[model samples]
Target: MSFRVLRCLFQSTVSLTLLTLAIAPNSSMAQSLPYLEDPPPPPSRTSQRVRRSNPELDEYTLGPGDLVQIEIFEAPEYSGEAQVLANGMMDLPIGGRVYVEGLTIPQATDIIAAEYVRIFRYPLVSVRLSGPRPLQVTIDGEVTQPGAYVMEIPLKAQSGLQRGLQYPTVPELIELAGGVTLSADLRRVEVRRNSGNGKEPSFYIDLLSYIQSGRRGQDITLRDGDALFIPTAERIEEERVRQLAATNFAVAEDSPRSVVVVGAVNQPGNYVLIGGPSRSELRPGGLPTLTFALEQAGGIVTNADVRQVEIRRITQTGGEQIIIANLWEFLQTGDFENDPILQNGDTIVVPRTDAIDSAEVAQLANASFSASIVVYVVGEVNKAPSIRTLEVPTNTTLNQAILQAGGFTDDANRDEVDFIRLNPDGTVRQETIELDFARGIDEFENPLLRPNDIIVISRSGLARVTDTLETIFSPAPEINSFMRILETLGIVGD
Candidate 1:
């Protein structure tokens, strides 16, 4: 072979080798391979933004049952309303399915606008919360009603506009849940606000300060999805003192102190005495005398055993010291020293006979003083209703109560009348009293009637038997009357 032919062949072989190097399957390192793993997702906005500053958007987060409207400016075909599904996504006409659950109004607008730019030159998109879900709040601990409450706000449309939200205050919500219990610790209340990212920021509130001074900044306005937790009080006495202080009472200062009057007194309630140096200033006619205390309690009744009148005083260490007074002896002998002087927080109890229960001493700390006592007169009373419940003067006697109840009927067994008394220990005491119409004032057998006394001027046995037989055989509408008669006569409880 000639040299030129050999060179040409060599060039052809070299060209073919170069072409093979260029086209025969590029190197695995030079060309990209099919990825077995998923590509990295775009950076999420939730991961980048730590906090959002929109007040209206932060007030309520997108959740199930929330209705929203998306508007694309000048593009009516794509603008429509979409409810957030339970999965937190909504399907739009062109944007398809998009997640807006944790996104605020502004963030949702940005995401929806980004998707619409492919369809329009300038997508002037806007997202609006047309209808919000029900306003719900969680109240935990020491409140009377602790649970989730749905706020019923009337969204009355005014001038073709819906009413704005009336965000409930901490106190109002507490009241709506039946108010805070007495054991609640108001010093440090917790309020947690949702940030829509599984993170809840909390703040402390001093409810006691607001209740005491009506302070402006202490009670904050609560938003939807907010939670309030009132803690339990450690010391109930201290909280009670604070409660009294909040009521404008001078519990610790020079204000008047109240004393409770209970038992057989006419009025069973509290009477106030001037505090400080004037506490001992029981004038010739003032509210500091044992007699004055009795008067404030509606006076001692005829049934009250004056020899056993007790004055219970609470010591500084919460101990009780009781002093018994024999006012009957003092009245008979005309002695002033027997009538003792009353102090602040003293309780005067005029017990009936010897039935006083020592257990009531503990209740004296919170005994309420009412202006009048209620007594029931039944059976043979002249009142049209047959049973009369009367709010009579404190310390009223049986005869006076009967007179107040329109006196007894002709068939009333006055000598065998039943006087039922309810003791503080919840046991009932009943006695049969004999009353002589001609008896003198000193010889009167009528006993004093205390609060909740039941006086039964029952008819004679003949009348009761006649009524019972009439009820069983009359086939009349007065069957209830016959049953009641039987019940009153201790016959048929069935």
Candidate 2:
């Protein structure tokens, strides 16, 4: 055979072998290959159900402090901009007070339309929530803005950045609120939502995923009145293992010693043995006192019951021991006999009290501390302040700091002004300063004052005593002694 023909014959033989293998399946091949039905292509992502807005089923409700716009078709006289009153009613021009409490915009519109029909011919009413709707969401735990944020819109991960240049994330919110303060449990973030029907469902989002993986999807959307709780990390339980490995706390390898302090304590959690004096020196055997624990837990909560305290302890042999201690008795009298010392593996539970007037106390405290050493008046200001605080530095001239504090209080005397500096170390220094208001060179040529320095304006010598009193009482007191007096008298409560 020729070389080309031989090559063609070989190719043909190879092709035939492949054809035979492709056509014929061997028993071993069939047995070796396990059958796998392709997983039914994953359930379709497209939902079939039509999206409907069910206001009644939605947990959020319309409330006061929300701005709304009302329009009455064919009855322009009744249409106007109105805010929801505290009573949940909006006064209309012709419709009187329309009860709109707990109604959505559409629902409110329908109700208003129905009411108008009784008085008018086929009255068509439309209501639109015009302002940032009031939402009762708590940006708590470790949020930058840890408070009640109005959930005007459905909160999404994208909504965070839209608010401002420095938009805060779930983690950022925690950071904004003083970075969880001191004892924030960042590992677990709890988001709780109230069902419209009164049931509350809590969802736990693990912070570790976001912190470790840099995943933004982990940041969950919050609903109105949703509560986000970042508990304190379980330090006692885990720290014990580290302590045992290091042998730092003198915790015996087998000795069962642990204590759990919950409720109203600054650090309400499990605590392990630390090789040192008890937190309270007053307690016998240097055992941690209720007061000390409470202080560590951030002081007693206003609702804490000082009378009812329970301690639960687990013994070495797996036995549980419970004791009831009166915290008030222990606090009032150094009554160690009645209130036993906390042992290792013991849990202390503080009950909530009914007589706790936390809100009233907070209001009074806020009123008392209303003095701002630094004041600023922007816009129509001649000079601006560089510093505002109670403690003005020695280098801070009154003239310069006042310029930074937003300049003289309208009728401020340029020459007759002095500033007082209260040192943290208990020294009061006074400075006689002159401001060259005429000259536009108001910039502080010398060292500017630090923050929290106090700036005071001295009246001109010709000014009367009554004028001075008027100036003194002009600004609202940050801490109103009158309010405090009323609080002490129990005449007013927050």
Candidate 3:
């Protein structure tokens, strides 16, 4: 019972009381606990995004091969479904034959249901589509894949042949066929369909317009067995014009006794020499002269050297004669005698001028400076090859050398041709030339030809591998004749 012991006990009691007060839960904490009697209500259905059950579809038109179902709840025996016939008419019980050709499924169903109400009392009718409705069309011509395609939307008489189809556009159809190749024309397209009277109606559609402009509504809708034809491009039309022109020129030039002047002239090809008393005294009346031939070939492309002119003549006595004439001297003195008349099969070569030689050397030097100069020629002519180095003569135009090796084959593009000119400074220039043979009088005066120019004569629209092979083999007769001559000379075994 000492005073110190009593004080220690009192202090320990006070500490225990403080510890119990800190650990005990208060009334506010107990009140915050969730009540078992009122658990959280099930999650509200409106909290999540709503999902649509059915997707929106475009309106449909009923046609033949479409199956429609009809049901009458009040009078089951009075209603029955039927398929539309080829005539676009469908027969229903108590509804008779109703034309549903141009009507949508809903529209056709309402018509049939209205017809049934007249027969049955308190009639409750419903129509449902049971089978696929197929709309057929035919595709022909230049499409990569041509065939009949099914139309997703049934078309009425007012619907275009272009719009009712699945593709909905000409460009889409073109894309469906794996896109246009190099040969596709795209300009001229024809849609052929049969009229109700059993006659076929042809509709011309320009795909180029539709593609250039996003006009899907203008496309023709395809129908079953409808034929679509895609023709070639405008380039082919130019070729046709050229061919016609060339043919006419050939006929006109061949009609008169023409002189064949070969070799180097500004324009060294063929010429028709006019004969007269005044000009005849210089040489035989109708013989074409080198000057005349050069005039015809466009005055000898730029670098023709007038200093040295060589003429080769094959004589009748099996003698080969050579003549050298100076055109520069003839020009200065106006000597018609020295300007010899060119005979048939005569070759007159105009040597290159010093300017041309210097230009060629400069070109070579420029080519060597860059070390990346090449030229290539493709299409129609013989020796379609590529060349390197810049030593080609500046005056050597495409026309001069195209026939020098061998002329164009049958499939050569005569009219619309492309020239890809590559400059030494890594620049490219493209020029389109018109080679119309029929209008020879106009075009022959100035034939555009340049060296290092690639003249591409596109393949004919109708050209096929078989046609190319036939063209290649067409020279068999000429080859056989040459072989016979060689055998006569005891050169080789026949």
Candidate 4:
């Protein structure tokens, strides 16, 4: 259903009534329900003093902190107002102390009326309840706070039909405990309820159905002492996570999460990731994604295996779980699941591939997770600085790096550059390459540069002779001091 339709359904009295009946414990239409599909007939709305369900825990009754007004039609002296004490006893005119806690209004009124029979031959009694005690429920797994929560009876209802009678539902219970984590799987929320027998029975609910489609019976109306557990999803997809995050069920944006990003990244270390901006107020940024971690760690290296990226997480259920992020597949098919959002304490590992394709490097260099790389451009370009360091994107070519550093100066050797690249095995590959911008990019031409590659743009023969003469006339100390001054001014970039 569209959001508008879902909101409208949640606002209707008929919807609440149907939801209540359809999810009744014994009703066959529990979690398997496609729709309301012949919901049980609504219970008669006669003055039954709020006996909504037959189950002991599900029944609504007077409790401690309740205010009750008792009336006797025939005998005015026997009528009075009483607040139930902590011990669940109320002081009445005739009954003196009657235990009314956990009893329906009419049930307690009858007990009080029987006590008044001694004062009058024919005694009629009525008891009204107000300020019903808050419902106490326990929530565990995937919620911000997984413990007992006291929820005030909310006044807002679709209509007054369910206005005074609506108890807290599963959604309200979740909100009470704080929003769910990114790992929460709303598809199979287990609500453990008192079966009235010795054993507590659990019912699995697809809460997303109710949230998205306004399906009846999916969002169980919680009762006092109900326990809800939101299990973590085994796997995730981007769109599904985004859909839930847009709702209040997901964590809020701007939340800071500390994480460790290691393996095959330029800067492999700890990082603090901030939640992305709210997609909109209605759809908060929700949670930081794996790409957010990559961005924080200075991007993946050229040999990174995007297909086998791993996120090691400490699950809400108290064990570690490893989830794979197939970014290569995501790149191919636009699957958001390949780049799932993250929770706190996640360790993202972008493993290295044994064999990397050049095309893959080109593709990932343009990915959002790509960060800058440092390359030394010495003996090059501008006359003022003979040596300069340029921080450019990974896979930036020799030509691109040169252009970014203001290109070569007028005296620079136009035909060739000395390229020195460092190998991971602690060896250097040095070569003098001929420059031809028109020939396009290739291994022998404008090859893609790696981290810490060195490029030398030697001066032309005439410029070299002029520099030799200048060096002969000038002292080495003065030139060294001038270079030192530039360093002090922070003009020679790193």
Candidate 5:
């Protein structure tokens, strides 16, 4: 046999072995290999349906502050207006302060008519409710204002689905308390009611559903002494808000939303946040930026430490989210992205230079917001002695401040100028630098002057000795007389 015949035979044998394995039965393969199936679907994320309970309206009972009018058929003298006192009793001509509270209008009328029978024979009497008392309801949690509200009788007959007599609803109560804040979770509104059996029952209202569907039974009429609680939306997504808005419920934006700017800024106060379309109404200003806020605040003062500007915001759970913005880096890079977008109820605090720290600098950047930022120049300049307290805009170089102060004196030692600064910890820092005015500010060691910076140019050695000699002699008459005597005798030169 040739080599080709041998190779062909080996190939045929290998092919036959592969065919046998491919045609193997499933039972045989199952013994060697484990079975596999696709993974089960993920669990549903849908929340449970909220339980709702509507308050009974037809069986409304009388309480304190409700006014009633009683009329007599034959006699006009018996008809008068009466008010239920705080003790739940009413005074009439026939009945001396009878308890009428907790009784419906018809029940109270029967009691009054029976009392009138004692004074007259077969007196026909009628009772009518004159006015409803203000509903005192307590609202708590997640609302902009949480407290007791004395709401007037808002019940009136309306057309359509609300055809029955309507009273103050949950939405009306929330509106009375300044409406719900941004952190409110409209999905879970809880109303706590006394079951009259000494047990307090809780009813959960899904305001999101009511807002979306405009359902008939969702908005519950609040009862006197009923406690309404709105939960916080701590982990709610923005998409949920949009979905609610897509429904019939209109989401109203907070009006007069103010942001406070405090600390080292020139003016520290609350500035109204001009958001939405109102921002565009400004004169050529597209929006309200940090720059606009600082401008409204009269810009940062000389001692402001822009490196650690803090923007504090309130979270959904009434907690604070502090974001430290470094305006210095933002100014350097000229990046608008570095500046934070101010929100309602935000507070911006610009600390002093000495107070800036690593923790503060790590916040968001919002620099390039200041103008009229002043730096000081003192010591051996021409006007520095008389007008030592001088100020120039921020980023004014060392040489420029010195030149603005009428330049250095003839005896000023330019080589050993002392620069004093304040550290974040309130410690005084001193630096010695050599400067040559002929080289100009750009080409030489002319660092930018910061707020509250102090520059001191020392006097020459000869000038210092001359000043010391003059000071010693001017204060002492005896020393002066001796110097004069020595000068007259030619022993000492004038």
Candidate 6:
């Protein structure tokens, strides 16, 4: 027989057998059947689901300024829209005013259904969230901009649960505040959450751990009335500032920073520097360091003591934090750690070396931190360019400057010359140094030239005497005397 014909015959036989069994329920065949027994109960929601890490999105907690929708199967009058009041109470059609604040929508629905049970025997009620209020939070300390921020959140729920809603996290708030400074301490970032209660609870999160590992363990979502505080780093060395600077939470590398470079540096003053690390060839990453800042302010002077470069930084407590940077070590060993990175308002003081070594001077002039300086040489210079100014290396000595200016004129003083320097304290220091053009460059006799230094080559004794006699012997004096008499006699009539 065909499969369809076999299935039909089987169904007819089963129907007849069930009818026979129904007619004789106490028979032996019916007693052996256990198919009518009840099945076991399903599991509860509490046992099935685990609490999500993000509390704001895990469940929609009712609060002030939120809209809730209720539905009762046949009782339209008792089921409509309601709003949570500022006092956490919601006015319903049946339960005058019910406190639903801090409770989930399902919890509020159960409470409302129980209240309506006294009036209506059967009330198949349902609840949903229609609207959510904007969140207002504050982030302070170690951030580029510390202030209040308002985040608007629009929500709609058809199943009375949060779906595909992305809540803001700790790092997102920090980014809104212009990102954290390189000196920020991410280990102890604190958050103060204000639940409807009068008490505010506090919690700490270590962003350093999160940044190191991609695990979002405790980077929790922020709620309304939440306050975040990122404290200043006690020591940048401990925090590994270079690593932090490379993160997205840190300030941008190209952003301009105002820094002051004084002491033994060319054009020592305030300058707006903007750049990234370009010196670290040994290690991988780098940052704008003391050497970089010096290059921004013209460059270091010839005799700068790179071994003890002082960086005076302003701490969070308004006190000066002095850090010593050694660029000489960096030049020798290529250790970028010897050249500490620069921060906004940092003052780099390249102190003057007590004694000058000509060999070191040559190396300093060739160093990347040192720049070519301009010096003015006036008074009987043979070269046209050096007569006004000469742009030479930082280690150029007095003899070198004179030779670069074409070895001075015939009447130039070979005995002594005046070296005028403008001091950093707005003072002009002029000193006459006895010169011997034939002598080699030295620290005392033929010292190195500084930027904007004025070398004054005086006239020789014979040249000065000849110039004085020229004035007395010239015919121009006689012509001036005759012209004056002629003007008195009106011979040259007006």
lDDT of 4: 0.73
Choose the strongest candidate by lDDT: 6
lDDT of 3: 0.50
lDDT of 4 at 133: 68
How would you encode candidate 4's per-residue C-alpha lDDT over 21-64 as one tens digit per residue?
65663243332233334433322211112223223222457778
Candidate 2 Cα misplacement greater than 4 A, ranges: 1-60, 137-173, 181-184, 196-198, 217-219, 235-494
The digit string of per-residue lDDT tens for model 6 on 1-494 reads: 99999999999999999798768644546433434444322223101122224344437677898787776655587778889999999888666778988987667777666555444433456666666766789998778888999876655343424443445778778777888876678899999988667899999998888777865433478888899988877665723776677677777776667888888887789976665555343211245667777876778888788899988877543446677777878888987677777778888888997777788888888886799999988888887653668899998988888878888788988888898888667999788989886776675678888788899988999998787666545566665866655554567754
The number of residue pairs in model 3 that clash at the backbone is 18
What RMSD does model 3 have? Answer: 31.5
- Across 1-494, the per-residue lDDT of candidate 1 in tens digits comes to 99999999999998986576457323432122222454423334211212334454444567766777777655678889888888998777775878888676667777776666445433566676677666689998766458998864333333332234445678767767765544566789899988667899999998777666756332377866899998766544433433523332113234344778888766678877552433343332332457656655555554566678887766433346676777766666756445665546778887876443222322221222223568899988888899899986544567777888998787777676778888768999887778655542221266555678898888977777787667556554674867765665678777
Q: Model 4, stretches more than 4 Å misplaced?
A: 1-59, 74-77, 154-163, 195-199, 214-219, 237-239, 276-287, 380-383, 403-447, 457-494
- Model 6 misses residue 2 by how many Å? 60
Worst 10 residues of 6 by lDDT: 41-50
Residue pairs clashing, model 6: none
> Positional deviation of 309 in candidate 6, in angstroms?
3.0
Summarize candidate 5's per-residue lDDT along 82-197 as a digit string, tens digits: 88999999987545567988886656766777666444433456665566788888988866678888877644544422223356788777766766655568888899986555
lDDT of 1 at 408: 75
RMSD of each: 19.7, 31.6, 31.5, 18.5, 31.3, 11.3
Q: For candidate 6, give the lDDT of residue 286.
A: 45
